[model samples]
Target: LQQFLNASKTIDEFPNIPESSKSLLKKYLTKDVYKKLKDAKDANGFTLQQLISSGLANPDSSIGVYAGSTDSYKVFAPLLNQIISDYHQYDVNSKHTSSWDISSYNFEEFNSKHKGDYVLSTRVRIARNLSKFPLGTNITKEQRQQIENLAIQAFNSFEGELKGTYYPLGKLTEQEKKQLKEDHFLFKEGDRFLKACGCERDWPDARGIFINPSKTFLVWVNEEDQFRIISMQNGGDLKQVFERLAKAHEIINKVAQFSITENLGAITTCPTNLGTGMRASVHVKLPLLSSDEKIFKQIASKHHLDIRGIDGEHSESKGGIFDVSNKRRLGYSEAQLALDMYNGVNELIEVEKQLK
Candidate 1:
């Protein structure tokens, strides 16, 4: 702990950190944890923290790193898309991303091989930004409202399974809101992490959820990003869950413009969510594996997966159950990200069975 804090005074150690981010870091991070960013680089002298500052401000920020747009991506996509491909830092051909091929994914084909009661519900979501607009931090309150109004209009235009009602957070009673959250249909309060990063600027003024009658298809307005289109259910039918989101996304895109580039499909506030912006996850009990943190890390690391609490990042697992999801999002297609997670979960479930 002392070593981490001591690193703050030695910013010279991180030559990759941009000057602007260095100044910003003074306000965002304490001396502690400075070492974590020491050698983390992306492009020409671009540190990871430059792309994700919320982690320094809020400890609860899951990976504590966001994938905001790099200077290169910002030139073309502007703040609309946050595309950073450290994977090919030296030679990134395009700052723009391709349009999403929603139909390319079908979770049934990639379902977990193991079948057990250990698995609970499954969810897949994508974060998208409205094109031609600044990010949440830089936008004004009026702009936020405009984005909200546009989203409502887009959602209302939906037909078939995509049809739903928008429930503004301010309009719902406390009890009603609690019920939705209990069912995992709504997001909880914005955490300190987001508050520090400027994502909580307008609060509930333009924020809410749009849920279809079945609640299987939903969209969060002005939450973590401009939109969080989701598909989820009580069990691990990844194919059905992903299919719903893809279909709904197709419908919404017709009426709305989501920031996209040749390299990044959807723009988002966080750099980690830059590429596909898909977070496909499941709730499952991992009693045996959880008991051994080292073993758990080994297994999860081997599969490119991450473990979070049922309530999400920085929270503790309860009743021996943990939330598991993919770690990589950028530089891959939506189908690839989901497929990787499905394969990784299968591996975890099989290993859990062996431990039992």
Candidate 2:
């Protein structure tokens, strides 16, 4: 711990920390805070070093830390709170609430305005963890296997569109893994951030994915979180995508008790994703807009949207395609965030139309 702290103090010896790193862990873990919280441990004995180990290892990580359990938020409040506040732009003292009401997500206006081929696909996904278990960062192999079994049990209860098959990572062949990635049905492995956090300790022992017959609806079991409930399709029918995700979540909620709190909404491994834990995003091609970086950022920020490479965070954009999604996570209702992506994308499309 002291060695990493010393390295953090010097940019040159900080390992692979990038020159452009604006990671919260790098910014907030000062000498004073480290001394104050170094000896602190959560109920599960999750130490400050364990909490920030990932950040130290993956020096370029954006958020840098992972919470071992719900108590991590309280035990490392000073550091975690600062990082969360900076990333989400939410006041640390203020509370956040979550709303999973699907009835209020009326996207008629979005549907009406969106009428073009500029948008490729829309996906809405939410991260969830089981309340009875520790997060993936600290979960045991036995716990992961149990979660996988539990997820399959819940999946068996799906009566209609949600009915799907589970593909365990351990059983997948090399070709199958390649095929899933080519189809965008699987998350890429070897993420430095996840690896550094000890989430990959058991490797493919219990990780897997669930997909419906249509491939639009899916669930990632034992990934970064316990479940990444997703609904997506080719083309800009975000309304249907959001509806499908909401329905799947409701069904799964009946079988598995998700980790959540009154203040954090849905508890996740990272503080940045604490509330809501949902990302409503779309793959959009805007040659004219993306060409002008300044205008593109200006417009996206105006609509409360964030732009990432089509392949997701820390990746480069493919062609002119970019992944655009709502910026804020916590302190907003699910319906509102969905609407933000819906309305924001529509606005982006409108701006694209006028871009020449």
Best by lDDT: 2
Supply candidate 1's per-residue lDDT for 21: 44
Write model 2 residue lDDT over 1-356, tens digit each, in one string: 44334323323222344557778888888777777787777766667766877887776677889998887888888888888888888876667776666575666534346566787888999999988988887787899999999999989998787899999998899899889887877988988788777777778889999989999989999889999999989887777888788888888888899987767778998777778999999888888778888888887887789889877877789888899998888988888888788777877778788986
User: RMSD in Å for candidate 2, one decimal?
Assistant: 3.8
TM-score of 2: 0.92
Predicted candidate 1 versus true structure: per-residue lDDT over 99-174, tens digit per residue: 3454554445322446567678899999888875666644567887888898899987888888989988889999
Candidate 1 runs further than 4 Å off: 1-113
| TM-score on alpha carbons, each prediction | 0.76, 0.92
When summed lDDT is taken over every stretch of 10 residues in candidate 1, the lowest stretch is 75-84
RMSD after CA superposition, every candidate: 7.8, 3.8
